[model samples]
Target: MSTLTDRYVWAAVRSIPEKQRGELEPELRGLIADTTDAQREKGVSDADIERATLLELGDPVRLAAGYTERPLQLIGPRYYLDWLRLLKLLLVIVVPIAALGAALGRLLSGGDVGDVFGALFVTAIGVAVHLSFWVTLVFALVERGGVQRIKTPGDGPLLEWTPDSLPQLPAPAARRQSLVELILGLVFLAVFAGWFVWQQFNSFLTDADGTPIPVLEPALWSGWMYWFLGLIVLEGVFAVWVYQRGRMTMGLATLNLFMNIAFTVPAVWLLLTGQLINQEFLDAIPDTDADFDTAMSYALPVIAFIVIGVAVWDVIDGYIKAWRSRNVSDTAGE
Candidate 1:
């Protein structure tokens, strides 16, 4: 066989089982030769005939799949929608529960802010990976086993698809909104980064010697501040991803949820532990009849409440926006 025929045969059988390749390679080469010969009889040039024969045979991957009677995709059309639906549902429901459990366990075990945050992050990621792997493995097996349908309680038959089941594409207005959100999120992160740096050199609070004292603990610069900034950058990247997609998805919403938790839990913990604010800045405050600690004891709960409330609201808002963007009636005539 010519070099072109050799290349084509190699590609086609490379992915096939070794035992089968022995049989398939010769047959494939023979087929290509026969086709080239037939084309040559029609006065085609040798190179042109080889190219035409390869083109007519099409992609090697597909040809190999045909020979093996195996699918090229992990999960085929038969279970794709069902797999996606189940995966999204599990990510939304299970991830948050896992995060909460991890956070609570860390808190109960007297773990510090970093420990709790780490636990939450690791648990969420590990659980999500496990869920995805097991769910996909199950579906792939079912697909290969030739199972036609799955019946779920309250969901009817999984195999039956309808026009009503089609996902609604985001409207133009929704795309515009996502753009606006992306811009605002980037701007906010930029301002936050600037403010964090600025406060280290200049702040309204000053010591007895008139030196500016950062409102945030300077000690955080050692490590925690970098983690906080990294989260901010991640949030900005996520915003761009959402805008590029032109709509919030369940996975994005779940990510937003974890981001919120990651930020808020540490913040609330820092505030409660008196580790968030500068001790020197606190000491510089003019004395009052009420001690600062007493004042903060009453104030910290309120501050924590507001911080947590905002995070919770943001998470809920993301899910709502995702739902609205995906429901046709929600954006109709807009």
Candidate 2:
């Protein structure tokens, strides 16, 4: 047993943007309440009034279409270029990484040529599907809910529907996103993620005799790796932000300071616990004078000190750049 009101609301909003849903839902409820009240005052049965009110509102799909632009199209013209650019960007980042992974997996498993090609094809298709689904979803939402910016008041509320009015080029230098920086950041993220996954799921690199040597201590896998991985992700965010803004803002600088401190603490723990280098790895060094503990006791602390110093410098660097940029802006304004 379902109320006409509940069914209508769900149907209407199922296509709405998530952010707009809350506001739209309340407005819809208010409208329904008012309509139902008027019908009740006319001495109509509750069930009959509800049906009549809903019927007046008409099909939910058509009603919802009124709320958002391009309801029928997967992606509207306004968002099509951005959608295409993002799709290309995703393919650029993901395809190579997926191809590399497939090739490496095949090589490690001693796969034949046919198997290698098959794996590559499978991975490429999988990556493209994943990229397409997400990118299309985001662009469809944009078509529904994204702002229609008008640089001039002469322009109509809805853009004068024309391909010529669509944005052709990017913003000017210093304001535009850095393509080189973005590509580098993406490449770094891809490499880091791939390496971390390898560390988590597979054995370490093998020696000449195919002996699987472990690079990290067993202690690391317990919990510290998560902390390290989190910092890497945080750093990746900073990288992306830099690419987006073409420079760091005061907010980003502040975050950098906090992240540096947060990252350093766990890193220091790894060094202090002698978990920085595996004991077996230390032993593998031919004619090593110092044992695992001995080497760690002296060398590890120096490395830790260097790491801390570098982190402090990074914090200082971020703040200095932020301050300089702020000062430049203030001076230019004057």
Top-lDDT candidate index: 1
Q: Which stretches in model 1 have alpha-carbon errors above 4 Å?
A: 1-72, 76-85, 150-159, 201-212, 221-227, 249-255, 286-302, 319-323, 326-334
Q: Score each candidate by Cα lDDT.
A: 0.75, 0.63
Q: What's the TM-score of every candidate structure?
A: 0.61, 0.43
Query: Superposing all C-alpha atoms, what RMSD in Å does each candidate have to the true structure?
Result: 13.5, 19.0
lDDT of 2 by residue, 46-80 (tens): 65787666655655544565666434544664455
Q: lDDT for model 2, please.
A: 0.63
Residues 5-107, model 1: lDDT tens digits: 5546656776678789988888788878888788888898965676667666655545676778876455774455568769988887898789768977987
Candidate 2 off by > 4 Å: 1-179, 199-211, 291-296
> Model 2: clashing residue pairs?
none
The clash numbers for all candidates, in the given order, read 0, 0
